[model samples]
Target: MVNTKYARVLDHPESSIRWDQESPLTMTVETREGEIETRYGRFVGGPADGVEVVEIDTGVMRVVVLPTRGMSIWKIESKGIRFGFDSPIAGPIHPSLVPIDDPSGLGFLEGFDELVVRCGLESNGAPEHDEHGNLVYPVHGRIANLPADALSIEYDEASGRLELIGEVMEARWFAKRLRLKSRLRVRAGSYRVYLLDDVTNELSKPATMQLLYHINIGSPVLDDGAVLEAPIEELAPRDELSAGEIDEWNQFGAPQDNYVERVYFTKLCVDDSNETTTMVRSGDGSCGLAVTHNVNHLPYFILWKNTAAKSDGYVVGMEPATNFPNKRSFETEQDRLVTIEPGETKSFRLSLLPLINEQAVNKTSERIKSLSETFEATVHRQPKAGWSDMS
Candidate 1:
């Protein structure tokens, strides 16, 4: 058996220590000569050694950015709280980490730790290209699996803010030339994680762009008695398997033997600020989590729930995207594809915060309620006969 015991301090001046069971051997130690007992810094040796990682900890939260993996946010942690999934493979594992040459879509699923960075500049669905075989986009595109060209981090002592910046290029000589410039900000003594992104078409010719923040949540934060709360205007199952239990879309079930996955497409209601939010809370009402994002850049939302057996690992995904992860060709047909003019750039912002106590959870509930009242809530009527399949 592997002994995964690890220890770390919470706040400066000797506060409490929290141990997370997500990663078996992960640990955070305070440095003697650091700014304040190791608040934030860049480090190697991610989930496993040899994998480069940059760790930034606000007294309230800790975020791990894998520079070698398209700057993916590999982990999110707080006192006795974890919001990401555990993969069988280790490290800030490289894209070629797997031995197979063509794992198809499964490649992305293998190293999908927490926040899998996505790029819509090329293709995002299964492996497929044009009839002429000129344009080739790998599964889930090539951003998350590609390494960042440049990575930097800065800490502001006066404002107690830490920012991690990463630049990733998904370009070829005669193909697309798109750049993703991402910045993540965390404030001391706060539970919020802010993300500001700017995707630019670096080429002289126009290029199609699609970006999705695939945020996955699992375990303690997502268990029985958990409920999904959002200003949802409409909900549709992805396929026949999910449509069977369409009524239970907002509730989670215990791990079962043969539990199939279900995905719900939601039309969310945005506030006057043009922002939409979603919350997932523990059944006991102890702790919870919330995600807020602007709707202008991200107009679509997807909720993926998988209640597979315990051995398989249970997880839920909250995806915000400019276009669904369908084939780029299909997205173009729907006219949902976003085109960036030569040298044109667009921005997207979002934040994730942990609801530590009842007060925090209640605040989220109240906020959702206010939004529901302020805007018109979509009334979902039962399927007239059999459920409609949209997958």
Candidate 2:
């Protein structure tokens, strides 16, 4: 490896070092424990685009987390303080291989000039076991928050208490598009998204309640081969479908020639391994994530990917959600529809459990049943024993 001593400081425990290389943003750090070393530190554009390298310790754990286009975390001052996550140059809005929106002729979803997901909130639906021992996936509601004037900025530096408190928002360093109102988590912590014209809304209910968020989970090591492992309890198939209608991934049919939309493997049990999902581009981001969680009320899960069509060999976009896309009206239903009466409020909490590929996928379901501490079914809906992954 070409090692060059770039001018920077290394903080211990929570120490960090940043280098403004000729290209992309790169940062490095060492844990206070001093046993961990991070390398391959980089930033990319959006959930489905370019990337920079991110590393920990001395190549111990590497990750390429960021978008493909607008490396906001790396390009803070370049786009000025007032930046948008819309990349008009990003082309179309289609997860071609999956059930992503085909927002063609209908015009695009106000893309980013550098194109990051521009919508205020983006959500995924999945299924699995809930905290109370119930089947879950595609939890209700989405994840996204915007302070009155949220900007796409970069993390000029990363260290202890990594954050920048703005007027209405707070930005953190050593993060993808490292700019967010620290206060955002205060209101958005519970996933109970709310909007009021008089409070934070620029206008009243307005014409539509439109919000789009590109929960970027980018990688910059795709050429080295990409591997994503997401586990769940069950993968259910959908019932009742209309011609050319949107259906679940497990229920998709054969495609004549063009690329097929996405296939969703629903209701998989979020066992120990299932909870250990992570994004790896090439060899970067190796064991960068330890665990994850669910934000919605449901426990189901959905996986997203950017297949062969993607240009960069160093980028990957994989996500596990709770429900299907555009299924807002389906909330609180037997499947996943919200049943709220007049002026009702609800909250959802989700966490993450990142693990290595070998630990996440190699282990079989038998191991889960054997290791399961407390396994119970609160809602014994007749197991739909049908739906499966089409891809």
User: Against the correct fold, how does model 2 do in TM-score?
Assistant: 0.39
Clashes of 1: 1
Candidate 1 per-residue lDDT over residues 101-162, each given as its tens digit: 24344456666655445555566554555677544555667777777756666567676666
- Give me candidate 1's TM-score against the actual structure: 0.82
TM-score (all chains, Cα) for each model? 0.82, 0.39
- Candidate 2 global lDDT: 0.27
Model 1 bad stretches (over 4 Å): 1-49, 98-103, 126-137, 374-391
Minimal lDDT window, size 10, model 1: 9-18
lDDT scores for all predictions?
A: 0.67, 0.27
Worst 10 residues of 2 by lDDT: 75-84
